[model samples]
Target: MRPMPRPAEYGQWDELPDVPEVPTSRMGDLAVLDVRERLIRLIDRRRSEDARIAELEQQWRERGGVGESPYEVSRQWVRRQTTEGALMLAGILDRLLRS
Candidate 1:
């Protein structure tokens, strides 16, 4: 079987522009630090959300076999995780943009 082409190999990679270095000015330094900190927090929150979702899925799977039931516990778990993650992302974006 032929290997599928990755999106990056197909010229689909979108790189973010690099942040310019701030001079020794106090205010500029503070602003740069704040932006860097906010970016770190945003990444950490996203990682936390991903980990929580993964844990929930693992727990759901370990619950037992999915028999002939109509309602799926894993599906419900995923729905809740997605909603919560979206809410968290909104808060993160608000903080990042407001700063």
Candidate 2:
């Protein structure tokens, strides 16, 4: 394999490093904690949604939700759930960032 070029070789370095500093306020700390809690809640919500999705999928299959293939049905269910999860996460992130 060919060797990759270094970032500096492309003149990418600038005057300042692109690191973000931690906020030094009580609200900043509370915001961090809120984000953590929201993240945990998001995880739990995903798990529950996944389980419900699986149960519904099994029911659908049993009720003759057949299509071209079982994979097609499973993919549709996964896609729906993923879209919902993405939207939910985007909203949460927006709120957290604004705070």
Against the unseen true structure, what C-alpha lDDT does each candidate score?
0.46, 0.49
Locate the minimum summed-lDDT window of 10 residues in model 2: 11-20
Separate clash counts for every candidate: 0, 0
lDDT tens digits, residue span 1-99, model 1: 424333334322122222333444534555456765555554465456556756765675678736432233333333344444445545554454455
- Model 2: colliding residue pairs: none
Candidate achieving the largest lDDT? 2
Q: List RMSD in Å for every model shown.
A: 11.7, 14.9
Where model 1 places Cα greater than 4 Å from the true spot, the runs are 1-28, 65-99
